[model samples]
Target chain A: MEDTAVLSEIESGQERIDLIRKDFPILDQSVRGHTLAYLDNAATTQKPRVVIEAIKRYYEKDNSNVHRGIHELSNRATAAYENARVRAASFINAGSSKEIIFTRGTTEGINLVASSWGRKNLKSGDVILLSEMEHHSNMVPWQLLAEATGADICYIPVTGREGLLDLSGLDDLLSERVRILSLIHISNSLGTINPVTEICRKAKEKGIVTLVDAAQTVGHQPLDVQEIQCDFLAFSGHKMCGPTGIGVLYGREQLLEAMPPYQGGGEMISNVEYHQSRWNEIPHKFEAGTPNMAGAVGLYTAMDYLDKLGRDWIDEADRELADYAVNRLKELPELEILGPPTGRAGIVSFLIKNVHAHDIVTLTDRCGIALRGGHHCNQPLMRKLGVESTARASFSFYNTTQEIDRLVEALKEIQKFFNQ
Target chain B: MFDDIDDLYQQVILDHNKSPRNFRVIEDADYVAKGHNPLCGDEVEVYLKMDGDRIEDLSFQGSGCAISKASASLMTTLVKGKSVEEAKQLFAEFREMATTGNIPDGGLGKLEALAGVYQFPARVKCAVLAWHAMAERLNGSEESISTES
Candidate 1:
């Protein structure tokens, strides 16, 4: 969480982290009679007391179906919900609040673009360029679109060790037929940060609409949708320590205005007739029936929290943690790390020989350390990497070095158990 | 947390996981089925060489967590000499043992090591993936088995 009031707290570093850890009461508990070492931040982050309390306050005091009720509670809910939209837009440094449309989460946000913009523009044989490292949320919707429209799909292959996108063949791929380029800002599994500006700039020049799936990066780093210059951006609040069922889709004003409505429902329409209805303006047009009001309250607080803590601080901490994790994990001859150590983010994916990812995860659970073990919803990437699955330990700023050590110790124990 | 790691990854289980028994294609196999545990990305191809009602030979090949590989390995050894009817009964008992934590009585000797998996419900699928595939193969089902989460 970033905050100006937490200047001293941000500058304090480790001592600050010690205090910060206390904010999340869930961290204090034990999972299996051992202290919980939550390393699954990419999957979902634990909520701090302040964020939780905000949701509780909203439900208790300001709970109402947003946007239609004329009562005081409705006004409060609408205010909170609209304020959240403003906060979400500002969080990404979007051009305007109207650019920010609330959806269930990143998946829904992406589906909105694929179904609405994709359906309207993409024709049979037109190409949608994607990166090899995109999450299924970003890929599958387009796949379904391709099935419906017969729009061809191509990928920017992952280059060398760090799993960076191979832009060498990008020119060949970005021909006249390429209509849209939807790519991941930071790979959820590999932790490689893609060059969004360069990629988006290229696609923009080609008149291809650009969408960035910022699900993994928005929470951990400073985001500027204007700087990225993508037509659309999608991310989940839950990934950023906010509640689930709340997410943001930042589309360019003109693009959102031009695109058809994603879902037909009450709030999305300006006026409903028996058979025909006029759609509402940009952001509201995208948001369907009763939005997650409590989620908006909690998400606003979460963004406030992250801003207070500072993005630079979180990024530095995660980089250090990932480097430490990669370096420490690399010491074992039996283990092989997935991405390069140099500039990768907080996530570290690795494999121990002859050990199934599930085995490691299951065994680690007993030790009270949560590590993800699977394809990580990047099944195609997994297949490309020549492994079925990998064990991933993704860190958040609230996580400490001591926790990483705990994960390391637990992993060693797992190895010894299997090795012996 | 529920049980000792040793209880789940027993010496016998570890041994099978390390050197899975009959981990190869049974040439001219009467039945073949593929199993996938999508959650763990475990894939097992179970092959059977049946002689009339008897399982003349049984084998499997797969890569997975120790639990999955070990389960498939142990299954091959146990089912190799049993008749098709006996194998079916054994599988029923295996499923019963996996679903309920009660190590079912009578005749499921080495297979009982998988009892530790019951405590961790997620791993129960891992333990049963191969069995599900083999059951499908034996029953001549058209669909490939998938243990999805």
Candidate 2:
């Protein structure tokens, strides 16, 4: 555990990856008589053993309803849960744990914000600015909010297949009538890394509230709420080597305090009467029911494991795999890549002429290479790119260049099978 | 690879997908219906010209995956000159084959190429998308059908 030993271990990347690979038990298996090469990280990540153990340890030892009973088990459960909140707050460099609210994942976090803050602030004439490449989770909540509040929803257009934002008219779009600017930090399908810090700064200067959907960026890269300076940020735990049914929503303290509670129930109330109830503080007010305590514990361990692996290293490793996959896929003449040629993240979306994405996915699955196909919940973006669907290969830090090679070979065999 | 995937993407299916029959719009079609699978973004438009109780001509045009496209192409040829009642029976049989993996009494002929779709629960909808549209049209319903619904 010496600093020099750790430095040397990280210096040898392959050895470190081998060690990391052993931490995920699911990866050591075979699928369809071939070694599994999982390239579907964009959908969800395989959990590490430590995270799994953390959840088990919580349920076995400290299982109790948090902030309730006067017993020791309840005290232990409350401590673990609050400690997870502290970890989440620190993981994103938020001002305090009070600003971190746990929810069912990124989808629920967005809905909570839309229902609570959006309903309270938006007026009929106001505009909610979004981007064209947003996932359905980020778009649908705002659409519902707009419908209820009579607000107009506008989009920052995407520029063709590259999936970069067309910000030429951003100033005009950020007019006085615009109330909020919500966008993704990194596109899940296209691997486009949006300049969220700069975008948040621009929105801040225009006095518009900003929310960054960090669902795809948080685990792969270093995230600091102070650096991004956004009013709100949302991310899922399952996408980051943690358990499902838990996520963090980091909001500015003032904004969270001013917003009304998203739901009404037991734990979120300070004083309850037959007809009226006083709400609790910032985060507790939004958490209306019994929270996912085990999920929170698993997320805390996952975050710790990720920090140990180092964000800078994970980011570099992911980008390297994506670039390698993109280069190898380019060898096929009919393949057309979607996303930036350079500076793309770990995701690579592509289409082959005369070969459907579903076919590619099904064929590649035969070779034990998993890939995502279809709109990836960005149907509007898919239509904008003039494709019904695209095959996507997303990577994580545990993925190696050899896995990318297997993917390339599988894709070649699929092309040949289709006589392309 | 071919051996492993042949059952799902049979040679007949690939042939139809590559060069789909009746892949054009019929301007004077008596019935037209669009089929969509919003989950995967697969869409197909079925065009039919019926002579009383029998289908006089059938065609289709759309963009979708190979399974959906091939299924649509085969559907156009299978039910082209068949009577409305016979086509409905075939539709029911096709649905049965796709969901239960049980071929009809004498087998489904060219449509049997899609019988393997029963192995893939996620792709059964792809195999039946065009059939659903055609059935809706034959039943005199002009509404667009979605496999998701």
Give candidate 1's error at residue B35 in angstroms.
0.5
Candidate 2, CAPRI quality class derived from DockQ? medium
lDDT of 2 at A275: 90
Could you tell me the TM-score of chain B in model 2?
A: 0.96
Candidate 2 off by > 4 Å: A1-11
lDDT of 1 by residue, A37-117 (tens): 999999998888889999988988989888878999999899999999999988999989999999899999999999999
The reply for model 1, stretches above 4 Å from the true place, is A1-12, B1-3
* Per-prediction tally of clashes: 12, 0
TM for every model, in the order presented, reads 0.97, 0.98
Single out the weakest 10-residue window by summed lDDT for candidate 1 chain A. A1-10
**Single-chain TM-score of chain A, each candidate:** 0.97, 0.98
